[model samples]
Target: MTVMTDRPHMTTEEFEDLARIAAQQAEGLRLEFIGGVLRSKAMPDGDHGRVILWLTRICMQHHPDFWLHPGQGIKAEQYREGRAIPDGVLAHEDAFVGQGDWVDPGPILMAVEVTSWDSDTERRDRIERPRAYAQTGIPVYLLIDRLKCQVLVHSDPDGNGYETVRTVPFGKEVKLPDPVGITLHTEPLKDWVR
Candidate 1:
């Protein structure tokens, strides 16, 4: 929480280096490249991690065609434009399965910041990142904002963005039938132990 430098953004290479260093050092921190910036986010709680895990698992059951890749420091491209890491992402075999990389062939689905307190950048991810991903012709963008304990689903991809299909909260029945057919009972998300 005590950084001396005023870093608004850094290149993909710099971000990768920092990420590697953070992993190697036992500083016990979490990080990601958000808004072209290198940031060390606060420690995530049980709720944050489990929600993503559950989302990845159940989503795959609903749509076996797409693979829900783990948030394992893999590089993702924004329609062959910008590069950043996602909390959780989906890789489709038809388009980008055996390709160069997400940045090279592009990923058709991605998730942005879902567990942070930086309000400004968080909103930017919910707003800007989705727009960028949609422009890449990606079909879905899910913003997991626990701030209000809600999962905002955007689909029906248009130019440079997706429509706000619905905001599913705890105890709500959520549905996404376009790129995938998933009806999730999200009350467990609100009960996040983290």
Candidate 2:
């Protein structure tokens, strides 16, 4: 599929087909189909990326069955052209398929997003997008804001969107609802700030 970005553009059909090809052709390059164009975002910086890696590892270690997808875009609405590739998305019960045009509308147990430096984006991820996920009935959306050294968990998704149930700072406790009943400690993650 051809990824539409920058000034030059292509028809939506072209981008979707090419994006799938990108994922299949290269193992390292992560491709996501967004707005009918495959948008390949920059690879996360070493420290920031590692933070996401560690978190995925921890989640997988605790929940052995879930498939941990980092940088894989979820097809929130295939027909409507709504899509987002979350930082860390847990596909429970379904094994990871290497290439797919769309993902299931899920009651995804957890969706974790790591924020960038922009204040606008901070609000988008923390509030806007999560609300969309909540409206879709995703149970938990976790935001790890490396810029602010805070972890925000959005829980109890009502009909409209997610409500802020609890939030924790760098040194405080961060516990998310899970199948296995485990509360995690985040002080060790402080080192990834840089």
Candidate 3:
């Protein structure tokens, strides 16, 4: 569950400005505004990048018209007050054409998150992302949890959260339901995670 506070740390606009400046800095830090809180996202490890690349290849092969855009910012939450840069935002090739840094969630087919080997991965990836994406009515949320060594496919968004959640251990073949019609042979994922 998302921990809501009495007030937000900063407005979405403020977070956006800070995130942009931070991106240009040497550290290349990425920030996310979720559940009325500002959180810094951890940089992905080598294996993390491989996991994303693996998914990207499969998504493109299955649906050539769709693209898995990495580090794409999205306007999230029920009221669109939150900003989250999902690990990969699956959408049509030209879905975000002419959009600003943050794009609306309407055209997003799926939001993918490959867990980072960070202390906060549990709450940020497992808890917060699903809520924010579901509230935004995102059709699917695919969580490749490295720590747990499982792949969770979240679908059937109902504003509160995803109504149907399917979890499959790595090495299993899991089907990502419609809007994102594809089957993942997660055997390769086994090699990517620790």
Among these predicted structures, which one has the highest TM-score?
3
In model 2, where is the ten-residue run with the lowest total lDDT?
Answer: 33-42
Residue-wise C-alpha lDDT for candidate 3, range 1-194, written one tens digit per residue: 77558889888889899888988894868888999898888888999999999999999999899999999999999799999999999999999999988998899999999998889988988899999999999999999998999999999999989999999999999999998989999988889877
By lDDT, the better pick of 1 and 2 is 2
Residue 184 local lDDT, model 3: 93
Model 3 poorest 10 in a row by lDDT: 1-10
RMSD (Cα, Å) for all candidates, in order, is 4.7, 5.3, 2.3
Question: For every model shown, what is its TM-score relative to the native structure?
Answer: 0.70, 0.73, 0.95
Ranking by TM-score, best first?
A: 3, 2, 1
Q: Evaluate candidate 1 by giving its C-alpha RMSD to the native, one decimal.
A: 4.7
The whole-model lDDT of each prediction reads: 0.62, 0.66, 0.92
| RMSD (CA, angstroms), candidate 3 | 2.3
lDDT of 1 by residue, 1-194 (tens): 77534544666666666766776895756566644555555555666677777887886786677766654344433524345556667766454445432344254454434655655556566765676556556666777777778877777667657765578776787776565666778787767733
Q: After TM-score superposition, what is the CA distance of residue 40 in candidate 3 from its true location, in Å?
A: 0.7
Put down candidate 2 lDDT per residue, 89-123, tens digits, no spaces: 77664645554654655636777787766545655
Error of 1 at 165 (Å): 4.0
